[model samples]
Each structure stands twice: as C-alpha cells, then as structure tokens.
Target chain A: MITKDELLQIIYKAVADFNSMQDVDEQLAQQANQVLFSRPGFTKEGLLDSMGLVNFLVTLDDWLDQQESAQSLHFDISDALENKEEALLTIDSLANYILLKNKKV
Target chain B: MSIKNSHILILSDTNQSNFSSYLSKYIKDAKVVTTPFNQLMQVLINPTHAVWQQHYALIIFWANPKSLFPDLEKTLIGKHEMLHVKNFFLRLIDKAERVLFTGFENYPNGFYSQFENISSHNRYALNMMLTSISMESPGVVSYLPGYYSPVVKGLHAVSEDLWYLSKTAWHRTVTDRMASFVADMWKQWHGLSVKLIITDLDDTLWGGIVGDDGWEQLRLGGHDAVGESFSDTQQQLLIWKKRGILLAIASKNDEETALQAIDRHPEMKLRKADFSTWRINWEDKALNIQSIITELNIGAQHTLFMDDNPVERYRVAQAFPDMIVPNLPANKLEVPAFLRSLSCIPATGVLTNEDMHRAELYVAEQQRKNSMTAFSGIDEWIQSLNTVVSIEKLSHQNLTRAAQLLNKTNQMNLRTRRLSEDALWNWSQTPGQAFYTAHVHDKFGDAGLTGLIGVSIHDDELFVEDFVLSCRVMGRGIEETLMNFIISLMTEWQLSNVKVACLLTPKNKPCRDFFSRYLLSDSHEWVFDSKARFVVSGIQCNVIDFN
Candidate 1:
C-alpha cells in the first residue's frame, strides 16, 4: 500500500503540473491546496471549475499511472464525481480513498 | 525570433483544446482559440463569421482524412474518389491570410504497408491530395511537413485512449511538436531564417587544432574514425551551404598557415572558395563573427556560430544572444549528428536556381570586391565593370526570384514591404500596381534578379510601394538606374508627382541616407518633380516592355 506522504507528494506534483498551464492570476486565485485538502466537504468552496477539475484530475491520473506501484491503476473518480463527491473535497480524503481502493485490490 | 501577438484559430472537427494549450505554452503572447467541436466545415465555409473575426494570423486545419472521406478504405483501394475532400479544403485557401494545413499521416493506410510492398499500387493517396492543396493555394496556405521531422521522433501520432475518451485524434506530444514547428516556420516565412553559419576551423571543423597539431596532423577526411567524423561534419556543412546557408570561418591561427592547411589538405572536402570570408587571427571569435556578418551584410539574428570550445561558444553566445550558438556535443563523433538534427532553417522548400548556386554567387561577390581595388577611382571602377542591368515588370516567369529579393533585401530596401510570392502575386494583380525587377550582370558574373521596384499608379500621381536592392549590388548604379527608370516613367506618363515610400528600419539606414538628397522635408517620402531631366549613367540599362 502507498504511504500517505507518498500520496501527498503525488498530489503536490499534480498541482505543480496543473499550475504550469495556468496564469499567475489564476494560480493565486485558485489556491488549490487551501480550498482543496482544507476540509472533507469543501467542493463548493474550491476555485477549480468543472473543466479545471477534469483537467487537473486527468493530469493527476496520467502521473499516477507512471508511478512504480500504480500497475495499470486508472484514475477513476466516478464515485467521488457521483454520489460521494465529498471524497474529492480534501487531499486527505482523496488519499484515503485511493489507499482504500488499492487495499481492496 | 519574437512571436508576434498573432491570434490563431483552430478549425477542426475534433476537440483541439490540446492544440490551443500547446500553442499557448510555446507561442508565447499569441492568443490561441479553438472553434466549437464539429464546426470545421462551418468555419471553413463561413469565413466571415464571428469566429473568423478574431483576426487570426494563422488557421491550423488538422482533420483526419479517414474521418473526412468516410469511405477511406474504398478510396485507398481506388473504389472511391477523394475530390470532394480536396475541394472542401482547397476552398479554404483564400479563406484566411495564412492557413497551416497539417497533412494527414499514413496511419490506417500505413497498416497496409505489408501489402504495399507486394503490390505496385500506392496506399498513401490521402497524403498526396493534401500536398496538392498546399500547391494550389501557394502563399495563402502552407503545408506542415509530415515525414522525418523533429516531431516524428518515432512516436505514434494517434492515441487510442484519447480518441476513445474525448475524440482527440492525436497525442499531446504531437501538439507540442507541431507548435514548435509552426513557430519556426512562422519565423522563417517572416524572414528570420538562418542566412549564414560561422564555424571555428580547429576542433570545430576538424578533429584536431590545426595550429597545434600542424597542417599534416589535422584530422579531417582520412582512413581513421576521428578523421571520418570531421569529414562527416564538413559534409553536413556543405549540405547547409548548398541549401543557401553561407559558411565562414572564424579561428585563432596564422592566416597563411591555416589557409595552407585548408588548401594543401588532400582529404579536405571544402576549400578556400567554399567560405564567403574567414577571420584567422588571435582576435576574439565574437569580433571575428561580427566582422564576417558585417562584411556579408547579414543580420546577427540570421547567423549561427559554431565552436568546439565551450568558452569560445559562451563568449560569442553571450555577445549575440539572438544568434544561434548550438552547444555542440562534447563527443566528437556526436557533433555531426547533433548539427544534422538542427531544423533552424527549413530543410524542405522549393530551391530556386539562385538558391542552389548561392555559394558561387557569394564567391563572385568577393571577386567583384577584389576588382574594386584594380581601378584608379570609384567612378572609373564602376564604369570599368561594363555593368548591364536588365529591367522588366515583374511577371509570372521571374516572380519567384523577384519575391525572394522582395522578402530578403535589408540595407537597400525603401519601404521593406516583405511579402511571400503568392501574396506578391495577388497584390501585383491589382490594376494599378506596377512591380519591376532588376537582373544585374557584368565582367564578374551574373547577379540573378538582385533588385525590385513596385509602385502603385493613380491618375497623374504615383506612390512607390517597394524599392529594394540586394546588398550584392548595393553601391553600384543599379538603384540610380531603377530610380531613373521611375523618372523616365513619370516623363513618359506626364505625371505631376512621384513619391518614394520609405520606412526606416535599424538595418535600412542606407535607404534613408540614399533618399535624403531627394527629400524636400522631414517626410520619409521623397517627393520628386516629374519634369526634371533625370539621366542615368555608368550602367547599360535596358527596360523590357511589361504587358
């Protein structure tokens, strides 16, 4: 199973990747870490729009697949995007969900 | 090269936000927008629509041929024709000022390569039709090179996952590579391509330093591996030269000894005549490069300097940051491949007769300069060469070469209205525009199509559109002859006013100074009185009737 620190580091890298394409103003406006990973139910409070969320998630998905232990693990946020949207509200919750999914495997 | 804040519109059937994202990353300051998905045909058909109002400098139309043709399998087997697809894209030629039509790759068709080897029939008919689109369109449309590019790098163009996920046909890498390609091509089209390459003679050109190793020991073409590598490097440089890139040497060595090595070296593929000029001394490479480019009349931005020593490279690189100073591979064997990989200058283009023989033209220029010393005075020297200039209105036959002069001339340009051949052709078709070309020849050699004069005639008044002369024949009386032709034109037509349009550029100060005598006021337009008798001397000028 992946450690929490490893998972958090991946999120940080994904955030940097996301910020690479963003303007400085957008980067500042969307303090992804403050709004995200701030609380369990912070989806509506985050600055990421629908496309931004999908883009960031897709980018994060691509990076995760390149990891050593990812082993064809897909970045499917269907459950979070569906009924359990709060699972993606915070970085900790997302990390726990990923850990839970990997442990199930 | 500075990327002009050009607005670019992406017209494609599929989602090309990836294209916009890449262009945003690479083509800084340029605004890139994609039309709504499935709006390619609508955008192409309705060019005057609101989306086209973005004033896009370029419209990249990338659509998969299979998707466009629907019956691609039948088309490949010759069961169905691809004319409708061709005409649909051809109509887009005049739709925008510039449309970069990214050609379709040989994919699903490429999968049938095993069958292609056994049969004589070609499977890549789609690629051919796409090329024809660019050919018919000319200046208004450009074809992105599809084969053997830096972008191709053995990567699969289509991503299955992306195709399934979001209908994005290609991978992100394709977008990135195409962005770079477009930027480079854009710069080249705007006259920012490399015109000259200045190289070091010692370790850069050959394997060993000629000064330290002596003439006989220099590793150039020979049986040894290092020697062969140097020979390969020379071969690469020769290719660039043949493609119209002028080569010069800037080295720290005795002129006599180094030249002797260059001449006496039996295995040398290059000779003294190959270089336009050389700077061989203990002087700084930076200064030598400066002198070489200055003597040749090329902008520093249009030059590339190469040296094996990093210190020398760094010094020159720092001095001229705009100049291309490739950090050559440390491994001697790798230098040739590295240099070969550079696409700074477009590798593929229609090479005119002038382009193919450019090195010899420069050599002839050197001869002309040398002959200048033989005469007692500058006037006597100018009269001695027996210079004859043939002038004719720019026609379809000589349009390409004249367009070259139109775009390339820097110092002697009057207005510097640089234009592509197709644009120039379209402009010349205007009822009032009269564009003329000057072909110079003398005792030295034929300087093919070295001057251009374009003007717009309105009733009794005339406006000079473009008056440009190549540096090869700058100081000669060609400009005066061309000017005299304009005056004679005014006399023949009985015009009241003649205004020469002049725009000041950093390199075009020569033009400003030339027009200073003709100017009545501070206006860059040097207005001339038509009734004055302006006689041209020292040139046997012949004006061909232009119909």
Candidate 2:
C-alpha cells in the first residue's frame, strides 16, 4: 500500500509534468499547495478553470492506475464532474477520495 | 529552439495562443503564425498578407463547422458557405508544402440538443471526405479528428468555461495532444528518424552478468519467466533490426565472455553477427558510444542508447544530449512496453529498398575498407574497383528513397532544400524539369542509388535546382563524374549554359568547397560555359544508361 506522502509526491510530479507541456502560470503550478489552488471552488480567482480541473483529474487518475499498489483504483473524473461532487474540488479532497476508494483512508 | 528556416501557419476559429504555445514546446525553431481569431476568410482572399508571403513548412486549419456555420442544419445557404470555405482551404493546400485539417469535436448535450443527430452525421461526412482527399494526396494533406468520439464522450473536446472566459475552445489536453501529433508529422515528413540503437549487456540483455553467471547460468532464453523476459527483449531488438534500424553493443564486460555467450548460447536470439559493431571493454560508456557513432559515420541526433543502469544512462545523456537514452523499467516485465513506447523505433512511412539493406551496405563498406590497404596508389585502387554508375529518371519505384536522400542528406547537398515526397513528385512532373538518380556499385558490392540531380531548363539555359551526393561516397571522384554527366546532358540538349544553384547552408560546407574549386561562379550562381571543355579524364567509373 502507498502512503499519503508518496501519493502527494506522485500528484505533484504529475502536475509538474503536465505544466511542463502547458502554458500555465508558473506561480500557480510551482506552489506547494498547487493542487488546492487549482481547484474550481478554492477561490473566485482560481488559476484552473473547468478544463484545467478535468485535465488534472485525468492525469492523477492515470498516475494512480500505473502504481502497483493502486492498480485496481479507478476513479471516473467525468462522472465526478457531472455529479458536481465536492470531493473533486481540491487536491486534498481528491487525494482523500482516491484513498477512500482504495480503502487506505 | 524551433527548427531553423521552418514556419507553421495556423488558421482556426478560436484564439490559437494556447495551441501556438504548445506547438512551440515541441518544435524549437518553428516560427508559428496564427491568423486573427475567426479571420480565415480575410486572409484567404488577400494573397499579399504577410502570412501568405512566408514559406510555411506546415499549414494547419482548425475549425468546427458547427461553430463556424451555426445554421448549417436549418439553411442551405450555410451549407454552401461551408463548401466555399472548404474549397478555399483546398486551394491553400496547393500553395503550401503540407496542410493539416482538423475535424470538429462532438457537440456537448446542452449546446445544440435539437440538431444533435444531423450535426453528428454532417461532422462524420466532413471527416470522411477530408480523409479521402488526404489519402489521394499523400504527404500533402493530413486530416486529424479533433476527438476520438467513442473514447471521449459527454464533455466534448471543448471546455465550456474556458471558451466563455478566453474564447479558447479546445482543452489544454487536446492542444497538448495536437502538439505531439504535429511534431511527429513534421519529423516524419523531414526524414528525421532514429537510425541506430546502442544497447548495454549484463543486466540489460539478461538477468545476470555473463562474467559471474557464466554462459550457461545466465538468465536468458529459458522456460523461467525472468529468462523469457530477457529473451523477449532480444526478440524485440531483432524485430527493430529487421525494420532497418542498425543495432550495436556498448557494454562493460570481458570481450571474450560476452562473445562466447552471444556466439554459443543455445537460447540467444541475437548472435555476434547481428550487431554492426560492439564495444565490450572497461571504458567510459559515453566514449564507447561516441566511438560507435564515429565509426558508423552517422549523426548523434539519429542514435538511441539503452542501458539498465541509471548511472550509465545519465552519463551518456549528459555526454550527448541529442542522443535518445530511454530510462529502463525496474521490472523486467515492463521492458516490452518500454521498448514499444519509444518514438524512435517507428518508421515514418518512408521505408525504402536501400533502408532495408542498410546493414549489408555497411558490411560492404567495411569490405571496401579492407581492400583499400592492398592497393599502393589511390588511382590504382579506383581503377581496379570496377565501379559502375547507373543513372535513371525518378519514378514511383525509387521515389521514396529519392525523397529520403533529398531530405536527410546534408553534408554534400548543394541547396539543402527539404521537400515532402508529394511536393518532390509535383516538382518532377513540371514541364522542362528533369531529375536523375545515380546508382553506384563496385567489385565489392552494390552501393545502391547514392546520388541525385535535379535541373530545370528555361530559355535555352539549364538551371541546376538540386545536386546532392551521399556522404558515404564522398572521398571518391563520383561528384566529378556526376558533374561530367550533367555537362554532357546539357551539351546534348543544346543548352547555352549550365547554372547551378549555390545556396549555402551551415552543414553543406563540403559541397560549397567542391563548387568553389571546380565551377566558376559570381556570387550565388555557379556557371559552366557550354563552350568550355569539361575534362572527365581520370574517373574510372562507367556511366550506364538506366531507363
């Protein structure tokens, strides 16, 4: 089983990789709480819009699927987006949701 | 940095700043020029626009018909307008070297619920028509679907919030994906492919070190799962070799021990004869790779190095940043997936007869090198080689190889003009344009078609558009013989003068030096007066007419 710190690092690395390809603002992507700031509900002036949220979710889901411990952990971001679930809003919530799904929480 | 002297023009309905930014990430020197948002018609009508004046390596048209023509389903006038737009884009394709047309992303549910069925059907028809047109005109037109509809549903490819906020319809992921796709197409069209794969031994090739485990005990080519995975990796390397990619070994081990395993192992899929060369000694792996690349006479940019040890891979990557050094997977089971993921292995739809026989040609070159020491004088060696040069007009059979040579050959190329295969064919078909390919062979073996010359006749004067010789045949007097042949052809055609285009590029210094010594030139044009006696005395090669 993967620890929360390792999972956080994985999420951070994925965001970094995705940002490397995108034209995202360096200030938002380079922050320690980038995932939180990227949330649609975090602030009215949040850096990431709906598309950015979707991309981050998809990328995080893919990273989780590739991990040996979380091989069976499959979270559908499209479904979550459609349902307007609060768990998909912030990085901490999303990671906790994924952990809950994997029975690690 | 983008590719030097390359430009890409983008015409899209939405603001293309994001797309342009993503594309620039992949293509270092590419100058990307995007039309003003939704101003496609204005640019299309005015040929004097600065965008139209520049030579674009690629022209991209990204517009959703549904968004561009909102009333298409309700009115016939909208359909007619779309047809006019399509015709305008087709005309632009004729003017440009390569054009990429993107299909519409599927409409989200709330946007146009009433005309959903009709809109979907029309988009499918549009994509099919574009695909058929692209097929008929290979290397010129490429149609890419905006989204894989079945795989991605509900949200469509466009982000609603971003579209409202910034007028950027396509999502960041879509833009990123398109960037990669365009980069691949550019690489393929230019014949910038990985030619060589240098691999390590021990943990990379097998589970155990050969020196410690001995030939029989090494975990390779056995019923055990670990051994089978190693064998599977070797099989994959062999498959790549068959695809015309040259393979070599750069490992730190006893030469005799490694050779013994490769030569005598019952389960070894790869043998000692498989590799073009091997450097199996306690030397710096980076230096070994350098020696291999130098010995093969290939550019470092066209080589890929693989090793299991991360330190070695890092050292090689640091030494030669241009060389591809893929990180090896920790689990051996992931090796096959890792190998398949490499973009360097896939052929760019331009495989030629010469590419298939590359290994044999290199071996033949080695044989020629061995025979060189036997002859005391250079002239004697040239005379005794029994060299035959066969010149033939470019045709469908050799078109791929001819285009590959034209795009990839730089050192001895006169003009260094890279043309797409379709563009080259179109140029060759022009009236009064003549192109010839030279096939070289000696007593040692067939060197295959290694030289190309293109000329155009205007007002009784022959203009040399392209004159390129393969660097493999550089030291020989083949260039002089090719020039003599051209002069003879000009004489036969009753041309007054032969003018060579002497466009100098950074890499074609050798070609410039050759012209400076032989052809009399004033600034840019190298002229050969028809009345002047062009001596072709000392070349012992026979020029055969190949129709």
Candidate 3:
C-alpha cells in the first residue's frame, strides 16, 4: 500500500534528519538528489561514501519499519547495491526501487 | 547564559569540519577555531603564540594517536614523545579558562596485524596517563570519552573510504553522537543538574487504572509479562529516589482510591512515604505541578514532569518551557527504555555522605517546619531545637563536598569563585591559608557540612577569600556564627584587622547585605572593626585544627 510519492517523502525526511544531526544547511538537504554523485560539505566525498551510504540506508530501514503498512517490507542495502546498482544511481532511483520492492512483496 | 557569543577553540589532528558543524547546532553563535590538520605538536610546543592569545570560553583537544603518530608502537622515541605530549597538555591547562581532552579510542584487532597489540597497549597507557594528569590539574581540565562501539550488528563507526576522501577519522554517525556527548559535558560543567521528578499514575505507573479494574485486577507486579513491565518502571523510580532525586505525583484521579492502592498494595515497591508531595485532584496538571515546585522551593528548570498522554505533556511544555516534559512511548512496554534515556541528570563525581542521606534530610526539613508553631520567638525556636556547629579543616574526607558547595551554592556565596578539587587542594597547601567546613546538627537531624570559609593571612590582615553557606541553613543565624568564628581566629593569630572580599552578583545579594549591615566596609573590602559591638550568642561551636 506504499505509493512512490509517500516513499519519496519518507526518504526526504530521513535525509533531513541526518542533515540536521550534522547541522548541514537545509538547502543542501533539498538538493540531495542532485548531489548524490557530487561531493557535499557535510560528507567527506561523494554522498555514496561508505559512512554516508550506511547512515542513510539505516535511517531509511528504521523509518520503513516504523510505518504500520510497510513493516513486512524488507530492503537490504547490500543486496540492493549488488543486484541493482543502477536503481540507486540517484535519490529518485532509490525511491523507485523501494516502491518496486514493496509492490513485489 | 546564552553561548551565542562564546568562542571555542578546537585543536585536533584530523579534519574537524564535521565536529564543528555538529557543535554549531547546539551553540549557534559559537565561533570555532580549528588548528591545522596534524599540527597538534606545533601548536602545543609554543602555546604562547599570537593565535593562542585570544580569549576562548572553552578549548577542546581532540586527537587520535593513530593519526598523530603512526609508528608510535614500533619505536622507542615515540614513547618518549608521548610523555612530552602529556606534559604539553599540562602546560596548555594554564592558558585556557576551561579545557577538555578526548581520550583515545582503541582499534579493533587484525587491523594493524603484528603491531595490533602493541598499538592497543600504547593507546591504553597513554589514555590512562592523560586521565590522571587531568585529575591532578586544576578544575579547568576535564576528560571526555570518545569510544563508540556499535550495539547493532552491520553498523560501522569508522569508514576507511571516508577517511581517505577528507581525512575525517571517525564516521559521520560517530561524530554526531560525540557532539551530543560533549554538549552534555558543557552543561554539567556549568552546574546545571535535575533535582526532582514528577510522574503521573494510571497507564504510566501501571497497566490499568485502579478505579476501572480494581486494585486486585490492575496489571502490576505479577508473573504476567505486562504486569512485570509496570513493576520494572516503579522499581527504576524507587532507585532514583534512593539516589537523592525527589519523586512526586500529579495525577487526575480519586485521591482515596490512589492512596489505598499505593499504601495497601502488596506488589507496590513505592509506599505512601516515598513521595515528598502529591496532587491527585481534578485541577489542571500544570497548576498541580506549579504547586509542587513552589512547595519544594526549587526552580522550574530543575524539575522534570512525565506523563503518558501527549496532550498533557504538550500542555505542561507550553505553560513552563523551562521545565523538562519528556514525550512518553505509545506502548507501555517501552516505558523502562524511555526512562533510561534521560540524560538530564548529571553523573555524580564523588558521592558525599550528605548525598546518601538526602531523602532522610528532606523528611527532617518537613518535621522542622511542622514544629515551628510551638516556639514564641525566632531565637527560642532555634534554641529549643538544640543546634550544634562542628568545624573541621579541609581534608580528603570532605574535599568533594566542599568543591560541590563552592560551585553550586549561589545565594549566600561571598566572592563566588568556583574552585575545582585540585585548585582547592593547592590553595590549602599555601602558607598561612586556612580552610574550614562547618557541620551543623539539630534536634531534627544532622544537616551535614553546610558552610565553607577560606582565610589567608597577608601581612597584618587576615583575608577572607571564600565564605559560603547552603541556603537550606539560612535564617538560623548560622552566617553570623561563622563570621564570629572567623573573627575569633583573627584575634587568636594577633592579626590587626579582618578583611572580607565581596563579589556582587544578582543571586548573591543576601551575602552582600550581611556584610554591609554588620561589618564596616569601603568600596571593595569589608574591614571588621575590633571596637564594634556585636552579639553572637545563638549556637554552640567547636573548632578542630588539622594543621
């Protein structure tokens, strides 16, 4: 029952939460999708670095588990990254992959 | 109180942009100056440089041994260099108002292969040495723990890829956690601590209401899992009460029914006597909490109110924003975990004897208040209570309590200079310096050491540097008695006059007024006149000299 827009909003909120922890600017948070492949001030390098990627995936997993309708939907970051690298090329692609995974479940 | 204008200087071996960013959120106007990456040695060797001359409210020295000295374990010279580093910190301690050093975190095995054990041992030894140094130095030095081990599997706190990119040693997640930990340390250093906890009943204290399900049917303290969860919550609250945090109740329930359950329930860990006060009525919960605060004579900022309902929490928060109103978990089972996460209470450094008997002391205060109507006059009331003052010189036995009183007591503090344990010890060793603590006891109970006085003989005059008494012992003429004792000491030492230093603070008006009314004073010093007539006839005093 999770729509793509709802999943995108959840991902955005998770990103905002991470940004606020480091006191990053909200404008940089809004440009998360655009900066996925670029180096941001908050992160050491590209947003896909080991620490940044793990923090975002863990937050997303926790957020999904908290939702009543999506508790049973499992999305492992390692499995997704290994099987469908192109699906996580950008923030929008990651949301699409989550929506597709929820539909399959 | 606002740290918006404060400056903080950070000296770290790694790139500190992430740490700086995180600290900025808590202290908005904090101007942070970071040393060049891997330049801790250069900065420490010559701390008298122009860059170090700037006034900073706080200075943080955060450096990892691995990054600072890569071959520290392989060479003998590196060990000597480590000792030099410790000496550098001791030197830097005198330059800043407040300084904090983060202890080195250990690395996991197999990372350094053959050098793993040696590296770990060296890091451990270095950290222990630094901790001891910080303890012996003046009150300005504090140690902050920086180790982060993930409790959840598949989570890493150190990322090699991130370190290679920007030279940021720790992961962003670890940095975020450290930021919060450092902020708490800063708050405790400023003497901010929680004193009282006001809790609600019903779903908060038990699974079901006693009125709805009857005391027998209420799910609390039974073999059932839900019942045990509620019992665990009550047990935790009792432990906090035993450790000097006053507990109270502010629930909207029938007073008689609640009292019966609290008093007669076989499973309840807390009895009717456990609470200092309660307001189980139909009035607004905020109003009830206000009454409790007023009765306790504690600031709203030092009180915490907890309830299960989010609406009530919001109402209290709106009414008293200074007070802490934590949001409760939706499920009753999560109550214990939620309570454990409260970091508002600071960790007690050294537990004094008074701390262990605080609950009994508060009960004695109530008894004293009840007996006040029997006496005809103030002196008669004081005398009828049978009070005694025992004075002892500063020793290791009472050093911790002495430092705590100096830092936390505001109302009756003269010269209001907070001294760290090490600073107080150093002051006591100076020639002709005398420090004393007054232990007070009455018919009600022993109030413990509630008064402090520090005097030093300079030339023909005895200088009073610090004189403070706990406000709990105020209005009993204890201050005048202490002053009289100091004057007696001056007369015995053949000093010409007694000079007292008074610092003007908004909270210390009572202290200034005491000197202005009785003692002759000039612009900055109050000189005791030997010819002035004064009577100090209330309490019996005993003085013990340790020198």
Candidate 3 regions with alpha-carbon error over 4 angstroms: A1-105, B1-11, B21-34, B44-62, B72-146, B149-166, B169-174, B458-460, B516-525, B531-537
Model 3's chain A TM-score stands at 0.72
TM-score to native of every candidate shown: 0.81, 0.74, 0.74
Taking the tens digit of each residue's C-alpha lDDT, what string does model 2 give over B46-92?
Answer: 88887788867788988656544566555544456656656766787
Instruction: Score each candidate by Cα lDDT.
Output: 0.73, 0.74, 0.73
Query: How well is each residue in B303-406 modelled by candidate 3, as lDDT tens digits?
Result: 88889899999999999999988888887788887786565665534456776676677778778777888888787777777778888899988888898788
Residue pairs whose backbone atoms clash in candidate 2: B1-B28, B1-B29, B2-B28, B2-B29, B2-B30, B3-B29
For candidate 1, write residues A22-75 as lDDT tens digits: 656445222334454223444446656544455556666767877876644545
The alpha-carbon interface RMSD of model 2 comes to 5.8
Ten residues in sequence with the least summed lDDT for candidate 3 chain B: B146-155
Model 2 segments more than 4 A misplaced: A1-19, A22-105, B1-4, B10-16, B34-56, B60-95, B101-134, B142-164, B167-174, B221-225, B429-432, B457-461, B517-526, B530-547
Query: How far out, in Å, is residue B536 in model 3?
Result: 5.2
- TM-score chain B for all models: 0.86, 0.81, 0.82
Name the better of 1 and 3 by TM-score: 1
Model 1: per-residue lDDT, tens digit, B1-547? 1135567778777878777777777667578888787776666668587885665567787765544545454434352455766677766554455778776555444432221221113225656676777787665677765642557576556554455456665556566567767777766666678889998888888877777888899888778888899899999988888888899999999999899998999888888988989999999889988999888878888999999989998999899989999999888899888887776775765666788887888888888888889988777778988899999887899987887677767788987775667778888888978888888998889988898888888887878888899888887777778888887777777678788867887778888777775444556777787665444457898888643
Candidate 2 true-interface contact recovery: 0.20
| Preferred candidate (TM-score higher): 2 or 3 | 3
